[model samples]
Target: MRYIHTIKPLGNRRLLAGSCMLILLPLFFLCFTQTARAGKDPNILFNGCQVLFQGEKPYIDQNNCTQVPADFAADYLGAVISQDTSQKTISITKGDTGIILWTEEKKALVNGREVSPDSGAVNRNGTVMVPLRLVCETLGSGVEWVAETKTIRVTLDNGYILPESTCLSIIAPPPGNPDKIGLSILLFLDRDLDKQYDDIHFIMTGIFDTIQADEIVKHIGQKKTPKDNLPYRKWVRDDRAVTAGSEPGDSSISIIIWETGG
Candidate 1:
């Protein structure tokens, strides 16, 4: 036995908290569809924590750059933000990675690597607004914009994704599932739930449409764990069992997750 216990995620995988197992097909990971907000002011969630701005709320420009105050950006990124008032530059530093932006330029120097994303830092009124999506992703955090309520949800590497209730707010919540933290994003696209659970094994069923599955994963910024193994594919995070699976030649995604306790 070579003990092939792990299959690398095609990209950054945002598996929620706890250990889970999946018996899955060979998934093809494609360019993840980016979330966008239309013409609406967006509320922000940072690592499951709601961000409170002093006076200005988050604004998505026509260029689709989610801009926030420099101070708030510093707080959200846990970085030190400094300004060059004379030269009109803002330097945001986290660990060894440094990013420098200017109020008049869309170009930025990320650790001496010059790059630009959509738009750049802007001085609106007396406050310097920073391009949040660019900065957050630069710092290695996953960003998802919920167009329904015009919300920005962030998943930091040091933090888990949105909590159960918040996640349910983004996805369809079932009528009667025992609110498991990880299961909040599991299960199906849309269905009524009448589940029975007493001990070890738990099961539920959903009409699995591959496109819908991809859409669900995209909506929440999660990629399905892929493996060459046809029927048995496993992608679990930490240390508890919660999984989804389906049978061969079947169009159903069955939910099968368990834990030690009842």
Candidate 2:
């Protein structure tokens, strides 16, 4: 950013300098526009891990809506995205939900239904910037905009977004329906709250890198794998049974705990 100017012949050089400054003025404005267009890069945490954006980073627009890279956001949201440069169109689909939008257009298609919003995806220096909320909400994903920190947190339905080094557990029949026992409810638990349960049957989820199965094993006293090679490992402590596992392809882990004795 440091500039060096060499002194030359006094009279004609002064006039030449003025002419050069005029030419560089437009170039300076272009640089400023590029930087300001993206606004600021608020940290985006997808599934408890900060997403590293390549080329153009995610930023907040003037309207306070988040704009993100098309491919990156599609992958994180578990949606398949197809782009047509010639048409300036983007199509994102997850399960039965479908979303289609064009660059620089506020009109978007959700499940073949047309709706116009404030602003849609736009092309930024060859990178297609899509509105994070518009697409995520249509696909049934969680989008949290933290105004204080200016950060965005996203969670997809396929997996749970968990806190670092901690698991969020929730007992089955969740509070009101305590009488509905022995019910197997698969929950993608993402929060922690005080709950009362006379009989324990809880499901938990957390990040693997920040917290592993070993951390939960201690709370359940000791674990033992049956010599007969049972389908699942045994975890025992204070008449309680706990089992924790993670998918080989996923970064999150799931734990199920239940009371072994009444």
Clashes of each: 5, 0
Model 2 spans > 4 angstroms off: 1-38, 158-262
lDDT of 2 by residue, 42-148 (tens): 77765444566767877767755677787653445545667777888887765556677889877776666667655689898887788876776666556675556
C-alpha lDDT values of all predictions: 0.47, 0.48
Worst 10 residues of 2 by lDDT: 13-22
Candidate 1 regions off by >4 Å? 1-39, 159-262
The TM-score of predicted model 2 comes to 0.50
Per-residue accuracy of model 1 over 156-194 as CA lDDT, tens digit each: 542232332221212212112244322322322232122
lDDT of 1 at 45: 73
